[model samples]
Target: MSKKNRQIVLASRPQGWVQESNFRLVETDVPALKDGEVLVKNIYLSLDPYMRGRMNATKSYASSVEIGQVMVGGTVGKVEASKNPQFREGDAVLGYFGWQEYGISDGKGLQKLPESKDIPLSTYLGVLGMPGLTAWVGLIEICQPKPGETVVVSAASGAVGSVVGQLAKAHDCCVVGIAGGPQKCNYIVQELGFDQAVDHRAGNLQEDLEKATPNGIDIDFENVGGEVMDTILGRLNTFARIALCGMVSQYNETQPAQFRNFGAMIASRVKMQGFLVGDYQHLWPQAQEELTSLLQAGKLKYRESIAHGVENAPKAFIGMLKGENFGKQLVKLSEE
Candidate 1:
């Protein structure tokens, strides 16, 4: 076993957008495990836009990350040593192990992964994990998109949005995606099979969106806010539904999110609801089963952007906030 455990800790809170100076990487000796505890060597550290909200001085749905504490994140790791009866040395598990190379757990939230030859373990941190579940809840349950209806997704190339678009397609809905760049727009349409994709950065957002959805949007799986949300709101058909997921566009903003189409809700009779994945814990097992089945049937496609080491997590996280990542962003800590 290694003598030291490396960690990325929060050095300070961000005022607006996250900066690398807000994080610091340090090493400390791994302590001996006590009874009923297991030591996990982390393999991958999940990077997400929500972390930016956690860096704030104010609290929203969850508590904020305090200075000098290990930055919080989801991780997939191998059990290095176990004094717990339920786990063995080589077992793979998923847990909220934070931004550290190793974690000690008492078997509370840790889930032992089942043996699978088809899917990669890294996917458990992204597609088959929170983002996947988020997409499912938003598109399948909240949006309730019907066949032949137009379902438009924002931040359409990111982890949650990509999965949302694909799932809508699987349901036979006319899926359109909104992404940042031409390359990402191409990936969402060409590779992911979205019916149409509009590049938000192209300076023709309204024109392109109008061209894409001739009958107007029936369901809006919203991720990015700001101008994107404002535009999508304008195109909502009467009785349209919107699954308000994350608003990464306003996550790091100094000001609160503003929507210009508040009147559209009345004019279009749109039903918009904001949700958290944890709110529907009861359906998780069903979601996992169906998502895995979708994977086996080759109906779902996913991508991951990996940063090399734990030390690079801050940079990667900051990049993800700026829309620099193409898919699910993660930090590689150790080999499987």
Candidate 2:
């Protein structure tokens, strides 16, 4: 019998919170590669909050995942067989191969990863990948963080937020991170070296955020929207910049979040820009270079919550959307 290829397909669109039933796993025969095609055995799958938005049948930067379609995701995989000269067997490649145990690529969008024992292949899916670029672009390009500014990043323990906090600190700014629980908050401050951390789940977000930003927030790297964002809005310094990234808090909400302090934006002359990382694709290589330097210098830290097997992708992805993942959420489909 042909090797079984396991895949996760979108079974249905989410209503409020995503259920496991929304995804359906199916098995199929691994197809033979055609000329100019490369067959990749997927190793790692990235689970990000943005995937939640894609599950909805709404217009966005990218097209929505249709029912019976393979769930969209970033994957790091090794080429098991290749008919394309651009890639060879044993070459590790990265691409939007979605949630599958195996993927066939024509080498059009598949990027061969440089051999590096120093950097784990998984890191390419996290700090050195989209999340890292998101952080770099938002802070350095949009926010233009300056020394002595007070930068507050919401969801500060996750992949993007964590990097934003660290990058802000590197620029000589005092960074205050807002995360869900005490453990995440402590990790940001203690391990990630943020100036302070505010636990948003403490039932006193406004008070705690005020306490953390005595100088007022000069920049807000917002990842979680709703009350956290509203609280940050209320604390903005004059001419503060807000890089409105993902709104994980409101992603699964049936009703939109009410922002009571939105008027503060106008009063404070804040400049808020909602951006997609794909828009800054040209800067990714440069961002990776700088991020890699920081990693080598021990100025940057990263963490991951990995789920084993492609079968668990739905569960892991749901957890990531709920802010249960400590850092970059990923699924290990196969060993490198």
How high is each candidate's TM-score?
0.98, 0.99
Off by over 4 Å in 2: none
TM-score of 2: 0.99
Most TM-score-accurate candidate: 2
Q: Tally clashes: model 2.
A: 0
In terms of lDDT, the best-performing candidate is 2
Model 1 TM: 0.98
Count of clashing residue pairs in every prediction: 0, 0
**lDDT score of model 1?**
0.91
In terms of lDDT, the poorest run of 10 residues in model 1 is: 252-261
> lDDT tens string, model 2, 1-336?
778899999999989999999999999999877899999999999999899888999998899999999999999999999999989999989989999999998999899898887888988898999899999999999999889999999989999999998889889999999998999988999999999999988999999988999999999999998889998999999999999998988988879789889998899999999999999989888899999999888888989999999999999988888888999899999999
RMSD of 1: 1.1
